[model samples]
Target chain A: MDKLLVSKRMKGRLVQNAILQAIFFFATVLGLIALMLLLSHVVMQAIGWLDGDFLNNFPSRRPEEAGMKSGLIGSLWLMMIVAPVSFILGVGTAIYLEEYALKNRFTAFIQTNISNLTGVPSIVFGLLGLTIFVRELGLGRSVLAAGLTMSLLVFPVIVVAAQEAIRAVPQQLREASYAMGATKWQTICRVVLPAALPGMLTGAILALSRAVGETAPLVVLGIPTFIAYLPSGVLDTFTVMPLQIYNWTGRPQEEFQHVAAAGIVVLLGFLIMMNSVAVLIRNKFQKRF
Target chain B: MGIPTNQEQPFSVREMIVENQRRQHWPKRMEKIAPKLLFTLAALSVLVTLGILFTLLFETIEFFRRVSIVEFVTSKEWLPWNEEHGSFGVAPLVTGTLLTTGIAMLFAVPIGLASAIYLSEYASERTRRIIKPALEVLAGIPTIVYGFFALTIVTPLLQNVIPDLEIFNALSPGLVMGIMIIPMIASLSEDAMSAVPNSIREGALALGATKLEVALKVVLPAAASGVIASVILGISRAVGETMIVAVAGGSSPEFTFDVTKSIQTLTAYIVQVTTGDAGYGTTIYYSIYAVGMTLFLFTLVMNVLAQYISRRFREEY
Candidate 1:
């Protein structure tokens, strides 16, 4: 009788285990379903609208005549400024905190401040851009202003990633350099930077890709949606791909929504390319040591 | 000591040391300069924080000069358009933000925690690898796309079932934002759960506990602080999110708790005001800064609280 009771209790526990496991499994399934729906829905709408004309022409009142040329060029110009500036600033900050800064209140404050900045809403950064870069500096919704804003927005991401990469460098490498009587800069330049390069590059590329998708900040900068001319310089007024997509999506017509989806496909294509390059750098160049 | 003997003069160490130091003088100068330069770069981040603070503060103060602080805080309406009869109370926008965030959390916490539990305790390494990056892809998709998805697809689908839903209601954006943040919460909580020692699970199993029981009672408790921290961070993200709400959360500023009705979040309001030609120095223009300051404070408090919980309640091995 005791054995039968034990068997019954064990069976009950097994049943409970299966139920909980299924529940957990389905939770992941739900998220996957949402992802799949979003992709398929966008792609299905973008089927016929994504063509050469869509990429070549400027946006017009008519859907078929509309293209993302100015938006694409504007985004390109913005990245021209964002890529170099953010990389230099981000990697520099990472190197300082990891290799140079003494452990003290000031360094600690900078670290905490960076963490807090990452949590600041992108729109707040937009407000910052509007006030300082746009109004105070008189850049006036130019690509330079937008690019600098995006750089600050993505700065924390690159810094944190680069810091992780720098921290992951083995201490033995630095010790060997010190043993050879190498100065701090020599040790860093020779032993540490090379080891950390792949990770740093990956982080910078991913951050750039993120900047591509950012729309709210650009919108808040008051970059008008219908720019007929391409931006030739940093100071030229510009609109980005996401902002174009945003404007299109907000329109009352059905064709504009489809056009927005096509724009999204192109934007996603760029993002996928960037992300794959990041993965390739991580896999192909990362040193095992 | 001053003069070397004839035998030692051929290899004088002092002369050689001086020659090498002089040869590397440029590098030595650069070494001194590099730290200061990098420090300046690092300090720029602090300047950014100060810029954001002062810009918002300066304008918000200007906004308060026009409208009393008490009326701004206590009033229910937000009508910056009607400057003469405008009610500058921030309550409607705050309520709208809270409503969307509440709905987002309601959906995200359960699914995200469940997915974290599955990934940490149930899935094999292969399944985890494949699923993890896929979820990250979900996270990587832009918020603007999510906004489009909510407006174009989700709303139409929801309208079929929930007939009372407005064309641009809070429910669609709230639900879509919930989907957007799921990956964030899942990945963070998974990292926390994975940090729990395997020995704890072993001990539970040795005591005749089932796998579910072990995960529920042992690992979950051990990783409680981390999971909570992740959820808090997710809440902050939801609170600060702009485009999704701006796109689908509607533009009307109303003081309603109903998710089916049109409402405007603080972020959506900022977008609305900024996108319009709110001429510089106008009440509407300054109001964006005031609204932005409120959003900034909300996110800052949540972020600090998350950091405190994670650091304070960490379970060290």
Candidate 2:
């Protein structure tokens, strides 16, 4: 009887453990289901709106006829401005902090503040953009203001990522360069940066992905909800994918909702593509290393 | 050794002096200058922080002057664009943000913590590898997609379950936000839990503790600091989340605690007000900065608290 009781208890414990593991497995599966459902719903709702003219023309008051040409162009323009500027500023700061600066109180303070700034809400940056870029600087409600605001939003993330990438470069490589009589600047430019480039690029892509989807900062920077014409210059008033989708989503018309769904599909597609590329780069770098 | 002839001599005093000066002076000068330049570059990070604070503060102060601090803080109404009268009560927006974040935490903490426990203690190596990357994929999904999911799918499902739910209420958005933030909490907490030494679990098992008991009593205690920090960071994410709230949460800025009602958050309000209504220098416009300042302070405090807790109480073993 004692032996039977022990065996039964052991079986019970096994069943319980199996159940617990199954629950966790299900939860993870549920996350995937959520993502899949979102993608499918977008595709289903947006199918009718995916025509040639839809991509070619600017937005119109008529939902059936409106396209995303201007918004797409505006987003491209914003990217052109934000991407390089953020990459340079963020990567430069990271290199200085990680490779050059002494580990002291001042550097520690700056590091802590950078992390804190990363936690600052994007809308707050929008407010900063409104006051400094839009009003004080007289950039007006233009693409330049939006791009500047977004650059601030992505800057901290890029800096953090770049710092990690730079730190990952082997210390021995730096010493080798120095022993070979390379100056500090030459060592960084030639040895450290090339080794860290892939990681830095991964961060840049991630940051840019975030910037592209950002709606709040752009909204606060006063991006127009309705722009019939393509933005012509940096100072030209603009609308981005998020703002355009937002405008359509808020409309009462059913057709407009369809258009909004289509816009979301396009936006999500772009984001997914960017992320996949980052992953590819990361994997390639890992293999090379 | 014999001395070289004058024609074959290495250098005269004048040439030697010039060569020595060129080699010694400029490099020493550059070494002195390089660090200063690099320090300035690092200092730019601090400058960025200061710039943001000063800009937000000045604009917010101007905003508060137009709308009294009392009205802004205490009043429940937030009608800034009305012609006859405009109210600047920020209470509802604050409440909405808190309520949604609270709901998000409720959903995220349990599932996320459990997942952490499972990954750290229960899962096989292959399962762990697969699940970890899958969770990261969840994190990689943009917030905009989450917004759409909340708006289209979650809202409809919630409406079916809870009668009287508005088209854009707090429940769906908060729930979706929780899902979006789960990877953050789970990943951090998993690292903390995994950091607990294997000896603790072995000792607990030797004492005849069940797997669950070992996980809960032995491992979790060791990882508490990390778990708490993860939760705080999750809260910060929920608070700062913009696209999800702005898209799904309604624009009705009311100071009510009802989760079923349409409410606006500080982020959603900033989006709404800034979209087209307010001119550049208008008081209505400066209110965006005021709202943003409040948000900035809230997240800043949370981040500082999380950092302090993690740094102060982090366990090495």
Q: All candidates' TM-scores?
A: 0.96, 0.91
The best candidate in terms of TM-score: 1
* Model 2, position A165: C-alpha lDDT score: 88
Clashes of 1: 0
lDDT of 1 by residue, B1-317 (tens): 35656664537678768866887999999899999999999999999999999999999999999889898899999888985788999999999999999999999999999999999999999999999999999989989999999999999999999999998888999999999889999999999999999998999999999999988999999999999999999999999998999999999999999999999999999899888887888888888988999999989999999999999999998
lDDT by residue (tens digit), candidate 2, A88-202: 7788789878877778888789889889988888778887787788888999989888888888788888889989888888888999999998788778878989999888999
The Cα local distance difference test for each model comes to 0.93, 0.84
Candidate 1 Cα misplacement greater than 4 A, ranges: B1-22
Report the C-alpha lDDT of model 2 over B37-121, residue by residue, as the tens digit. 7677667778778888998898889988888999998887888878678998888899999989999999889888888888888
- C-alpha lDDT (0 to 100) for residue B258 of candidate 2: 91
Worst 10 residues of 2 chain A by lDDT: A24-33
Residue B121 miss distance in model 1 (angstroms):
0.5
Query: Per-residue CA lDDT of candidate 1, range A62-91, in tens?
Result: 998899998888888888999999999999
